[model samples]
Target: MPYQKLTAKELLALGNAAPEVNDSSWCVTWDPSEEGSAAERLVLDTLPPVLDFHTSGSTGPSRCWRRTRETAWLEAGMLAEFVGAGTPHAPGAVVAFAPPLHVYGALATFLVPARLGVPVWYRKEYVGALPETGQRRALVVATPWIFSLLLRHLDWVRSFEHLTVLYSSAMLPSDAGTLLEQAGPGRVTLVELLGSTETGGIAVRRWEGGESPVWTLFPDVTRVDGDAPGDEGAVPLVIRSPRLGHRPGEPQPAEWHTGDLVEPLDDRTFRLVGRIGRLVKVNGRRVNLDETEHRLRARLHCADLALVPVSDPMIGEHVDFYVVPALDTRADELDLSPVLALLGARPRRVHVVPAISRSALGKLRPQQTP
Candidate 1:
């Protein structure tokens, strides 16, 4: 069979024919003009043994990657293992609010469950209707922004008592773990995934409580140590995994050099320091953008803020902060000048915008003014 594309309408018709079609798939698209037509193509096309997708370019341009059948199977098995899928009285079902086109949201929502023969209940229409279901043993895959919106509706929160797992990713805030734990009364298990489109899903953590988040390598993955942490102040992570993406017959690097900075706690667990590209030199001293952003968020009266690089003649490039003030809050109370001083540099500029522009998944849209 050769690969072919079908429109969403044709896909929907196929879906209507047998809503329980195990091998059928749909591609999520936000564009209204091509909605139904696009989905139909994906469904009718010859299914690839390996599915390929890209990540949202909130931080940068999206990168493309391929997922082999083995990779998908391994991911499904790991998810089942983590969530206790086969346990009696806790049969698992998947509900996803993230679009199926992107790696983080859609892959797990559709591929993992479909490959595992688990029933997936997808609502392409009203994503907010997720918690409104009556399913007892349910696993929800959503982004931080969707989770935050769901949290605002207490009625919806109460409806999730039977939920066993709540998974989130793509631009998750550090504090989100703690927030989820408090909101769910520990009945629901919150897992934060760390990975990109290029890397697939690499690590998982509880994301809340005082427990240190650690990376649990997939079954086929191995790590290589670069430099000791706190020495050069950046520890690079190297990966050798069978699950990595590559074209057939092409020689792939045995170890993938990830620009991610990590701190290893023992052999199995590690803490993410930041991305190598995210660090900037300020007056010859290195500044961690993650740390600076954390500090600025603490000082701001706004709901969120992001630090972005702006061209500077003196330093070649300098950081600027953008803030999204909370609704009904006065801007005068949110002074970021002191925060910049604390970060060891006077920011080139500060902009107060109506709201921070974020993707549907809560990733801060880099390069956007606000």
Candidate 2:
């Protein structure tokens, strides 16, 4: 069967007009709280009850999951309310650069408007000059990479007037956040949503002027017990949320242990510290880069170092240890022969650099081989 794409205006029209009686492979059962939209009512009356979404696989292998229409409706409603849609202060329309196939884009472009009656627009991909819409405000759904590119190309001050950006998939670089704030001041705001395909939106954080880094849990999501200390003072967090999706016939687990390590800031907020597991599988052997880095630092008595894992087709993931020698010690005087022999061919590459760029929060920025 051919794919049927629905636009925001057309979806609204479907809600207002008579829906076709023909049965679809898909069906919808809208949430009870979703109101004021003819299309939303039509979804409750007619549509597929379930849909399958594929994970982006940024952290690991991608998997397919099924979600009920009600879950989608509820999540969309929550997100719309969070972004202040449907009110006088709401954005003129939603503009998503991500493809709707991904969960993040689906929620931003499809589900959110389905609940709040917001008009929507889309881009083919995260590239090219953004078309100027005369609207005073726009809700932009994008990722960190796109933001970086936008910062390079666009006129920051004039372009971002009254714009709200939802950034996810990866952490936003601190410099980009700072530049955005400087460019637009109060007119532009960046919201970082911590979520995944399996769990939906769990928490959100924003860049405040000189505030500490922390993420606030969504009202429905709660932290579970059994969090234990992992390597390097990293404490893993478990979560229980209604938005969590489960496979068919599998009993819902008490909680999902998200591999993320976080430090509690208060009853409701937390700062992400690191990951519980940094072990990468390489050629039937496990390589713990964190441990290796620790050992290297202990032996070398140097603190300015980072071990970045880059994916390889043959080895799964290999380490690239970046070192910044002490001011007195020349890079030529440094020796890693012992470290290499201990690892037994774990790292595929190593480099000595003058300095390493880090985010404002003191986290290493993502690096690519130069």
1-370: candidate 2 lDDT, tens digit per residue: 2223454444433432123211111122233344456656665555467656666544455567666777777787778776767565466656665545666766775666566554455554444556554567767777545665566655743564477777666445444555566655576666778877778888887654456458999888998754467545546778998778766566545567877777777768887764544656555555566556645655663436777777777666777778888877887787777567656674677778777665312345565343
User: In model 2, where do residues sit more than 4 Å from their true spots?
Assistant: 1-6, 9-37, 45-47, 86-89, 156-160, 231-234, 278-318, 321-370
Clashes (backbone N, CA, C under 3 Å), per candidate, total 16, 8
Give, for candidate 1, the lowest lDDT window spanning 10 residues: 26-35
Model 1 lDDT per residue over 1-370, tens place:
1112343333333332243322333332223332233422333352456566665677677666676655655565566555555565243456665565665644566444543334455444432334333555666666655555545554554565545444545445544554566565655566666666666666677644556566776555677887555435547877777666654445544667667888777666677777776677766667878767765655666777877767798668677877777886777767666666866877778788877777656666675754
**Which candidate gets the maximum TM-score versus the true structure?**
1
Q: Looking at candidate 1, what is the lDDT of residue 364?
A: 64
Question: All candidates' TM-scores?
Answer: 0.74, 0.66
Question: Cα lDDT of model 1 overall?
Answer: 0.58
Number of clashes found in candidate 2: 8
Model 2 score (lDDT): 0.62
